[model samples]
Target: MAGDGTVEWGEDRPVRLMDRLFGDAGGGGQRLSAPAAGAAVVALALFIAAELVPWMSVTQQQQGIGPDLPSQTSDVSLDTVGWGITAAYYLGLMMLLAVVGLVQVTRPHTRRALTAAGFGLSAAMLVLLVGAIRRAGEGGQYGPFDQGIEATVGPAPYLAIAGVLLVVAALVISGWRPVMATGHRRPAPADPDEDDDDEEPGPIDLTVTPA
Candidate 1:
């Protein structure tokens, strides 16, 4: 109860820590912007497409008794590594980014966190991609390729990287904040007027007069 205490409206309610920083940010359905939303969607699409395309390839020649013997040619795609490559791991991360991006499009309050998350996820992808490449060299052969072979980075992985970068950029550009009307306040209950009868006098002794 407050010092002057007229019941201290809403005093009993809990306040979320986030509410203190950004205020209530009106939880309405307004979106960030059409271009930003479109970019997010496009990023998702590009990521998916990149996953399906070839990302790496390797070639090797087998020694034969005759010099005229032909060497075999082989190629591999991003799907070749499956979950082994960091690029493959990004499929799930990209999906998560897509979901967060969609929410940010509609919920302005989430932009700050969403932008941070996107950047972090992208950075992780880059680190993993480099790790995957390094691991390929350590084994004397890239993933799934024959020994003593050098794997060439393919266009698909590059495409996915580009897509992830775009998502980060899109998030940075989409700035929005909704106006918070007011902090939660309990409504004041109406007080009874002194002029109003508290209770009706028992049905006026009309029946008692006959006795």
Candidate 2:
């Protein structure tokens, strides 16, 4: 408000930028509810754990030339953080940004957008994991061994999928609007006597009157 009683819309450059990115402070930014916050935390933990754990395992077997010679077996495990660093980095970044947005952003629309983006990223990760697992299953021959390799999907991918579902759950929980209760009793009618009593006594007779 200005001295002239008109509303002022001017803002500093940084403040404008902040409002554009995070949200308007005057709007009273949205924050995650308890259940939604818990779900998000769990999802983040699951994603981190998934990155640490082995996502897939490949086993190679070589048959012995003769009965005297022994067969050889080797195993290779793929980890998200180790082999899929790029994907993990992006997913982690998205999750972090989502958490930050949920906590700090004031605009409901901005929060919703962040939640949607997080859910999309999580779903994309799951899809990539499924595709990778399927591709791994179609193993090719390696080295001089005639026998081909076998690939098995590991627990890490499933954990990641679980995390993705949780992310969606969090988003749903956050956006859920509670139904407002109705059927309140109306106020009782105002007393006419009370209204009469509220009236002010006006104009005392000041002129000299003969009784």
Candidate 3:
């Protein structure tokens, strides 16, 4: 009960919720670079472009009797399925991080960041693996080692290694920056006085005493 026009309140519900969520945020906080995001977007665009446009060609050889042989050139077909999957993966990753950044959401915990990266890479790799299986099933000219290398080189093994490398590269690129340490231990700001003390040198005694 208050006689005055202004009434005293105990606490605001929304304020409490916000404080819990953002931990009494004091400043604008760490942010993702818009330029970096743009770069990612451009790279994704290039990948899509390469997939859509006829950018590469392959050569085929034919054998004929009497040494009459000609080299045949053909435009490389799009790995439509594989390229689409890769495009989606890149776009999805950019969108995921962009939304988080735009919303001012803090970077996820390190473990979660790594896990997301791993999972995304695995999903992409799974798509490629499926495609390779289909190619094998279709009985293409691909030899026993049809994944990438010839029969002399193991295709399946190379593809697996490639997938692993992709995951590692993505993980490194996305999560290399330092963050709040594992224990949330923030670095203490340097004390101004301590800095001055370091900058100034102590006096040297003129008389030297031998020990």
What 10-residue stretch in candidate 1 is worst by lDDT? 1-10
Candidate 3 worst ten-residue window by lDDT? 148-157
**TM-score-based ranking, best first?**
1, 2, 3
lDDT values for all models: 0.59, 0.56, 0.42
User: Which lDDT value does model 3 have at 178?
Assistant: 29
Model 2 regions more than 4 Å off: 1-31, 67-105, 140-146, 176-211
**Candidate whose TM-score is highest:** 1
Candidate 1, residue 28: how far the Cα is off, in Å:
6.4
TM-score of each: 0.56, 0.53, 0.33
Query: Alpha carbon lDDT of residue 210, candidate 1?
Result: 60
TM-score of 2: 0.53
Clashes of each: 1, 1, 0
Q: Pick the candidate with the highest lDDT.
A: 1
Across residues 117-163, which tens digit of lDDT does each residue of candidate 2 receive? 76666566666767656544454123223254555566776786787
- What is the C-alpha lDDT profile of model 1 across 102-123, one tens digit per residue? 6554455676766677777778
The C-alpha local distance difference test score for the whole of candidate 3 amounts to: 0.42
